[model samples]
Target: MASSAFSAAKIVGLTGAAWLSGTIAAISLISIPAVSRTLKEDNLSAAHAVKLWRNNFEAGFALAPPIALATASSLASCGWAARNLRTSGVKDGRLFWVAAALTVSIVPYTIIFMKSTNDKLLRYAKKEKLTTSESQETEGLLKRWVFLNSVRSLLPLAGALLTSIVVLA
Candidate 1:
């Protein structure tokens, strides 16, 4: 095992990736039924449905900045590690991305998962507040996000598998 800080960061990051990926994948898989349940009739008047669409869109929009930040941090960390191989900070290459992704995803992922409270989203929710009613309306949207996150989980696992094959074969 690496030193305490190093290992802890790695574990925190990897755990976040696994969780984010799993939840994203689950969301992506189950989004359709959610839509159907919400609008029994396919045809939604613009005024009636706009709020719902925007709410979900707001959820995604909320996520975008964090995703951008997380990706940037991971990529930047990887680049720095590559330049300074002797340092005891983050290691080089995808490991850096993975670790950074994990460490960074914590708050954003938590915000999405912990629908029990909307204080975070509500703080930013425009127009009407993030009422408890929003949870039911937004579950599918959040689920889709989680499903996409699953793909992220799979990527690191794939990288590790390939590395193992090369070393042990």
Candidate 2:
């Protein structure tokens, strides 16, 4: 039963990490660029688009903590199991720890780098009217947000890669 649980945890961890990496990639590569173009056309359109995007982002963000926790928990479990079994050949425990650390780092990264821009965008999206300066500022913020968000994506991708290597090894 414990073995089965460990296996399930590993599967869930890998799945969550992969899903997060893909989602971040899509947002960075596809969604942000597409939305940025749309945002440039008109303020009303930009407001609506941002609102929709924020809603989607919030939904995804809400799920991230649980997924990250699960991934970290699973990696820790694998390490513990390996150590208990005296698996001398499995140096992958360090890889698991690295992956878990990366997974856990996402929260602080988001808070430190992404939160201010996200808050500003959300506030701007709520406005009934946007002046030219406001629109330009929004555009600037969006560009910065996209760049920072791309950086954010890399953390999970690295975590996923590390986790994959550990699992496969």
Candidate 3:
């Protein structure tokens, strides 16, 4: 039963990590660029871009915590189990530890690097009127946010890939 439970948790963690990575990739590769192009067109489009950004931000924020928790929990549990089993060589747990670190690091990464921009974007979104300068400023912020987000997206992808390799090995 314990083994089964571990397997189940590993599956859950892998799935969550994959989903999170994919979402981040989509946001970085597709959504941000699309919205940015819209922003360049006109004020109405800028407002629409803001709306889309807000929705994407909220959805990502909502999903990240739970996925991080599950990934961390499963990785930790697996790591502990692997240690107890006295597996040979450093690679036995090395990948899992790296995966776990990357998985949990997303929290601090988001808080430290992404939160201020997220807050500013949220504030900008709430504004009733934005001058051309303000719109340009917001676009600049969005560009920074997208770049930071792209970096963040890589963490989970690497983590997930490492974790999968660990499991397969």
Candidate 4:
């Protein structure tokens, strides 16, 4: 029963981490470019762009935390099981622990590094009408957000990579 539970946890942890990382990466690589192009259209107002950003943000906000927590829990369970099963004196679960830590760190990463950009985006988004200058500023802000978000996505990817290594070994 313990072995089966550990195996399930490993599968769940690895798959969840990979899925989270890939989804975020897709937003950065595919969705953002499409949004940028759409916003460049002369027919769309700044408000429209902001609305699109908000929709994306809300979706991601809803999705990320639960997945992160679940993945981290599974990784921690795998680590605990690994530690218990080890016969050697050396530490057994360090890789799994690190993987779990990296997976869960995205929350703080967003709060610390991505908050200012998010706030600025939200502040600008709330306006019914942006000055031409403010509209231009949104473009720059979006670019900054995309860059930071791309970096943020790496945390889970790294965790998934670590998990893969640990599991395969």
Candidate 5:
């Protein structure tokens, strides 16, 4: 059935997108702090710091496209799901199960922010003790990662909902 195809495709697409985004977030958790510490450890002049920062920005930009693709898939999935839901007499069980799966998938995206959030809250823990240059750099890197990751998660969900509205109309 065409409707069933749409539902199945949506689930598949969302699953793929969630996994892809989660993987990227995991990698960033590992890499952001390392890169930040490395940058600070160089102890370069201000000009060199500027250069390094620019390079890092460029690298992040380069990584953005695949992330975009992952999000796009979610958007598409949302549209598919919404379209399927528009029809009357659909089984509530199917819809409920899909919703449950989506809710579960969201856990990782939410928790991925935990480290950055914890770091922010724990700033008090280290306030009395002066953090090293490397520590400060790591914090900065973690901040950027959080910002980007937040954007990554929010935008896709927005796009998906937008698509659903547009398509369902």
Candidate 6:
């Protein structure tokens, strides 16, 4: 039987992973699409689109990394405790470590995969006057970001799924 502390950590880690995944999914599915609609349907200005994107980015930046670190930390703790506390032949918490790795992998994924799109968007946001081509490119960049973020969201969700299987097993 797992100790109370290990049980608590498992709960925390699993919940955190689920929450993180859901949050990112919401941003990709709901928030970004709405902002994109502002550009197309509403015929809003580039500055308005950039402002909305910046708002979402700032909020996500403030929220996501800390949650990732906390979830990964909790998962790592569960892994350590499970490894040390095993008494008989049973599945250990090694998967928890993998979950931790997946949950935190979003950091590098963002830095590597999403950085170029993010940089381009930021550059566009800063420009005082966008050329007609640059304005057209904004839509493409936003679409690319949505796709990248959708992929990034899967990482934490996979972590959460792995954690769930291990716990239920």
TM-score of every candidate? 0.39, 0.85, 0.87, 0.93, 0.39, 0.93
Off by over 4 Å in 4: 41-43, 87-91
- Stretch of 10 with least lDDT, candidate 6: 82-91
lDDT of 6: 0.88
Give the per-residue lDDT of model 3 (tens digit) for 1-169.
Answer: 2666666766766776777788887887898878897777654555567778998888888888778777877877766666555432224666677787788787889899999998888887887766777776778888998999988988877888887887777
lDDT comparing candidate 1 with the true structure: 0.43
Error of 1 at 162 (Å): 9.1
Question: What is the per-residue lDDT of model 5 for residues 29-134, given as tens digits with 9 covering 90 to 100?
Answer: 6554454556467653333333444454345446545554544544445544554565623323233334333333434544575445534434423343334564
Q: Candidate 6: where is the Cα deviation over 4 Å?
A: 87-90
- The candidate that wins on lDDT is 6
User: Which numbered prediction scores highest in TM-score against the true structure?
Assistant: 6
Q: What ranges in model 3 sit over 4 Å off? A: 42-45, 86-91
| CA shift of 121, model 1, Å | 20
Please give, for residues 38-71, the per-residue lDDT of candidate 6 as tens digits.
Answer: 8999898776687678778779889999999999
lDDT of 1 by residue, 54-155 (tens): 465456447644653554353444444443543444344454554454435545654565443333333333445344465445554434444444444454
lDDT of candidate 4 vs native?
Answer: 0.83
- Model 4 agreement with the true structure over 1-169: per-residue lDDT tens digits: 2777787888898999999998887777887667777888656777778778877888898998899999999998888778776532214778888889898888999999999989988887788989999888888888888888899889999989998988887
Instruction: After superposing candidate 2 on the true structure, give the runs of residues whose Cα lies further than 4 Å from its correct spot.
Output: 41-44, 86-92
Number of colliding residue pairs in model 6:
0
Better of 3 and 6 by lDDT: 6
